[model samples]
Target: MKKIVILFILFYSAVFAQSKFPVDSSYTVKSVYDKVKKAHPYISYVPARNYKTVKEEKEIVYKKIKDRELHLDAYFNQTKKRNPAIVIVHGGGWRSGNKSQMETFAIEMASKEYSCFNIEFRLSLEAPYPAGIFDVKNAIQYIKKNARKFNVDTTKIAVLGCSSGAQMASLIGTTNGKIAFEEPNSDKKFSSKVNAIVNIDGTLAFKHPESIEGTVAGLWLGGSYAEVPQIWEQAAPLNQTDKNTPPILFINSSVPRFHAGRDDMIAILNKYGIYNEVHTIENSPHSFWFLNPWFDETIVYTTQFLDKIFK
Candidate 1:
């Protein structure tokens, strides 16, 4: 009896620990800052400042799936006219990180007359691939359903993602109209399609010549390149690119590996005559969007691209 009880205890403990492989708190703006501060000492945390003209609302529940409740922060200017909306997705290798990292972008974009949402989704630590994808896509449906209240211009919706989030954003944006990626619970009246995408320092392909992805990425993606070649290709924006893909803005850092398959994706986009843009921040480190100078610089490019497409 004693031996059986001990075995059960061990099994329960192992299961509990496995369920939280990557603790969300383990990754934060401060943590990322600490890791890169030594290499780029000049970089500093981007302070959050409301435009004052824009209203900020946090923790708005967007979706409830089983035990998981997803939420987002909304920043919008009180206006009589409908405004463009941008759904912002944060990055932590898809394992850790939260919507709060995008608070600054939401606030600033709101001040610029854009209804911006900093959205949260289950990370790989909780629910692996496609689950997070569906969460974000469904959040878009929720945003569209409440478009009138938020003064959103449904025709002008966009998505902006950083690192792994960017990879997902590209996947979601390009896969628009594909029934294969649709979630049954998503709003039937509205689809999870966007007019534009902004990818920040994210890979276009996990299996490309310039890709450095290995164990760290493979963990979230289910397996290594060799173990799951088809899955890797399936997730790549390069593979999903079609003539229907929306206009994209690539705000890349100096790292080349992160830009893997980007040029190829661009080639396809150009073939279809779809609008696309790329701007690499010289000497900037990965995740530079969290730092000053670059943070503001990113907003500039973002708003500019948005205006070109939606304004």
Candidate 2:
């Protein structure tokens, strides 16, 4: 009778575990960290600055999809002279995140004489892969088209993003003039090419054999590397490096997962004679951009990079 009771208990436990997070689902289950984050979303981390001269224009519509209106927030000092611009893309593993998450960074950049556009894009939940690429490209084109209105120097623009956003920014910087990635109704007259790229610990390549099967990359790309090899290659910035690729700055954590393919990417860029630099923050978490001290250091590295590239 005890053996039969034990068997019944084991069966019930198995069923409960399967129901909690199904093993055969197309999407991977969210990590414990992701779950905790969803319950308590992170707040913005803006440092104390003496400069209070920044101005902002919030929720400027950039694209319309059916009834959905995508928008960007612009920040700049009200200067007569046009300033160089940076477009900030927030990261949430391609499934979550919004433009406002990067507002503090934008405000800081604005105070430093750089026009900043913090943009919103489709996540993997709404659409996957090329959808994000197209949205970011469209945002850049929009900014370029309306540069005069924003008092931006159209020629001096950079792309900066964290995590998945960083990956997308890298793609924009490397794949300029790649017609296949351009959106259908985008402003073709103005180019989406950026002068520099700042990658904040995003993945650079996705073709390795030991790559995980159902994490954020798998879900965002819509399949495992084995199932969608071409898409994986197409989405990787490492595979898209070329001569025309602009200078890149990498602000990264010491985590191996976040810095995957960093060496390979640098090697490819070096081979093509492209300028790039990597700054790894020791003893910091992957999401250090959202935390203190690290946040300040991030901005310092970022501004230095922009100053050099814009010069």
Candidate 3:
């Protein structure tokens, strides 16, 4: 009797969990847009106002090499044929951030005939440095492995992110086709790579003299410049750029420290004969470009660049 009771309890829990995120066609694009607006209240425009779910796994499960149970949310647009894809990485100083922050962007991309995904990676304090990069690589591989099912053009996929996510995005853009930090092959034979990148106010170098005292470098990298110099070098996206890497779009603000040395990165790309673009906002706060009219301009410029390259 106790065994039967236990089984029934497990069954009910599963059902409850499933019921919480029930899929409903009645959940219109406008409604989803409304939810996004309610949450952000800052984004100025909504592009992908509608999407037909090509694929969705609300609580898709993944077990890391470390045996960590990672939950990922994924959605794909079925409405488009052979669409380009964009994977979004969110930012929270590498210690905190979720996949949800990219939902509106994902939905908008889907609406615009581009398959999109918002990814969640392990956090810094929660996990560590290479873990986040590992998770992102895994996500890219997962998408490529399921490309046909999602109607995503694996060859044309782009990565975009903000803050730490921007660091990851730049990492992908600069390191595509390079296996600098690849894990022991747990799944497939190929490396995960992106064709383009959109990075927003992301830190590129941990070697900055300012990073010596106290800044994100100390917190996320787990030590001061003197303490973990090699770790900083290894974590820097600036260390990863090459010729075969994707074309890049850099979005920076007028804020001090944050936008510093981005031009240096562009210089490195130019030295390597790589294609890149920089769009700097005139006298704005760090990531404040995410607010009101600024967001609209940012999105417009970004999407316009995407359009130019995608075609």
Candidate 4:
């Protein structure tokens, strides 16, 4: 009787653990940061390192229309054989940020044998609504067109973005081959489809009741949900899901505001039988990708997700 009771207890414990959320549910931004800092004092204080081993090619023009020149930075391990690739977009509330913001993460990914492209897209200051979307789509098309030059496996490409960039990455992943978002001058011959996506605490829906006026999404989208309902609906990634949507992995911060509408997006994904995962970093800020401890954790889940889909 004693042996049976112990066995049952152990079995129940294992099952409960397995069924729990994939992320650390207990950690919050402040607590996790404090804990990590206590152990590694320099974890959040260290400057971004430009991995010396990874070869980097900067400012390669990916799109040229009229006088406007959009460029992207590429990083990779020198090899003749084709390898999986990822295009990373930076986030700054849709109005700021550049390719440099993604340099550290891209370099680390390149060191891991993935061809990484840190891309530049038009910001709200330069263009609004679908302009950034078109720029990102063009970047993917450019990468696909130059796959041989970069030794990138055309079929095994993924996109990763943080903040507003995550919104863009999610959009690109969900609306692949959708004609409505395609740019006029983009090389449409090469499909802009990606195999997977990684969204780091980005907004997924602009029409969420929580999305108010003066917010990043509202401003970048050129109006509030009530003012331009059509545009809001059109810009939302959650509404764009279909059976063909690629697998997505969301690495989020502890802030509930950052994950608004994520549950609804996941529901749509499930309804379509699409693969998706959400892993939250407890007690971490929305910008956790730039800090340590959380940064390493981000890479682990990212690499795991990409590997699973690419395989």
Candidate 5:
């Protein structure tokens, strides 16, 4: 009888421990995270959306290029009713990476009562810079065109991205009202303006002609700094800063060389008294926050920021 009681107590303790996070485990992509399943519940919690319709579908929004597949995942819950929407962009230096990295994030947002779209754009090597940005613009128009089907509020659309994805997100968010990014063939005139933006370790200085040299900027932009200085200069988000720009949340590591111009972007944002927050991980490695303790921290801070802005 004593042995049975002892085993019961042990089982309960193990179950409780699993509910909490494992700070000791190193961060890994979602696929490898299954190994530490016993110690982490956050992993399972992210991809379970409460929406009525949750599925994957592919569409061809751009026609200039063939074989370009635009993959999207969506979630919506009727009980929750109409909610804000957020489009997510994953980072792989513009050359690689896919929409799956944000599957858990999309689910989490849906659980929070926001319809979410995890989208994929063209890669630099495949089509290049303006191409990806153009892809984003088309995706927004497509969403707004099908807003009724997705149950999105349309007016409360927001965007979030990390690393290279951050750069693309910033560009789309900042250039919302601009005419230069408009798709010539599409009749969908819904404003591209995003209500809020969350950029993690993204560059804001793509507009600087001199800075465009010798980086992925060249490949994505389809030319080196020398070849198309003007395109690089105007393509960056810093050039589009203004008072009406949406609220922004910036999260980054404390690395100096990589994040050199983020402070200036923050300063520009302050001029408008528009809400902005920067959370820097002291001495943390670049993209370090994407792992464990920091990963959870990112979600908490990001969700809090979203709550404040969206509410």
Candidate 6:
């Protein structure tokens, strides 16, 4: 009876979320516009600044299914030295947010001679938890296979994500050798291993005892912990951490609740002698990466971390 109840709840949630997050331009699921609207008085836009962008290639399809396609935008600098790369994921509670949310990061990083790809995956309203996870992992695999074309140094690839996207980044970095999270593609020999992770305000664990993920998370995660225990456990980076997990850099907002399981994961990383850094942007609101001043600080921390690990 309990198993039957769980399946019913999961099925119903998936059906309902699809309706709520229907694919439309107005839904802004794939737009650069901020969705965390007016949650704070300071939650306003800052102009995106970048260096002399000699080249930017947009709408490059990484994954496709019939008419539906997942695209990534790549930013590049003029350099013969195979550039270090980043696969960026944006966050909007896993139900909203588009790839373009991270365009500023890509443009800025590219100017610094790093190749960055901004990606959009299936949101909870479109699919569910692991779907988004596999999309990112597969995107990494795609990047590795197409390294030469993108002028990327596959050995120095990193996954950078913001908000819930950060949670997904942590999970992807930890589960490097695992096949369960893979979404198989034409590149059978390609590996999705990332050398480092840049997690911006994404919690390490969703099934933590104190987790208050709420409905937005549930919409992406499929069901509550009671309904889908395994999915919740599998999605948490803290649970998947092993010696193979890459070094991680966490940039968090001032919110305490968002730092769920961070210290515990750091302990695990330390035990394995895996390098990690934590930078809390003091007095900053959540989604500060999309804002100014704090966003610049984040870049400094991220570049230093990535340089330490990859350079």
Q: Which candidate ranks first by lDDT, i.e. highest?
A: 1
Please provide, for model 4 over 116-173, each residue's C-alpha lDDT reduced to its tens digit, 9 standing for 90 to 100.
Answer: 9999887776677898888888888898899988879999999999988898898898
User: What is the lDDT for 306 in model 4?
Assistant: 88
RMSD in Å for candidate 2, one decimal? 10.0
- lDDT: which is higher, 1 or 2? 1
For model 5, the superposed segments whose C-alpha errors exceed 4 Å read 1-67, 78-80, 207-213
Query: For each candidate, what TM-score against the reference?
Result: 0.91, 0.83, 0.78, 0.83, 0.77, 0.86
Per-residue lDDT tens digits for candidate 6, residues 49-74, read 76775368899898986667888888
Candidate 5's error at 84, in angstroms?
Answer: 1.0
- Cα lDDT tens digits for candidate 3, 21-74: 222232233443455465456555433344456455555654355445555566
Error of 3 at 17 (Å): 17
Q: 162-225, model 2: which lDDT tens digit per residue?
A: 9878888988888988888888788889898889999998877776442342577888898987
Question: How far in Å is the alpha carbon of 284 misplaced in model 5?
Answer: 2.8
* Model 6 regions lying over 4 Å from their true place: 1-21, 24-44, 184-186
User: lDDT by residue for model 5 over 39-64, one digit each (tens)?
Assistant: 44454323243444453443334233
Give candidate 2 misplaced runs (Cα > 4 Å): 1-51, 209-213
Whole-model lDDT per candidate = 0.88, 0.81, 0.70, 0.82, 0.70, 0.82
lDDT of 4 at 310: 79
- Once fitted onto the true fold, the runs of candidate 1 whose alpha carbons sit more than 4 angstroms away are 1-22
| Candidate 3 wrong stretches, greater than 4 Å | 1-57, 62-67, 209-215
**lDDT, candidate 1, 1-311, per-residue tens:** 99999999999999777554446576688987898788888888887695767987889999987655789999998998999999999998888888988888788889989999998998877776778888889989989999988889999999999999999999989999888788876778987889999998899999888998887678777888898888888888889999999999999999998889999999999999999999999988888888876899999999999999998
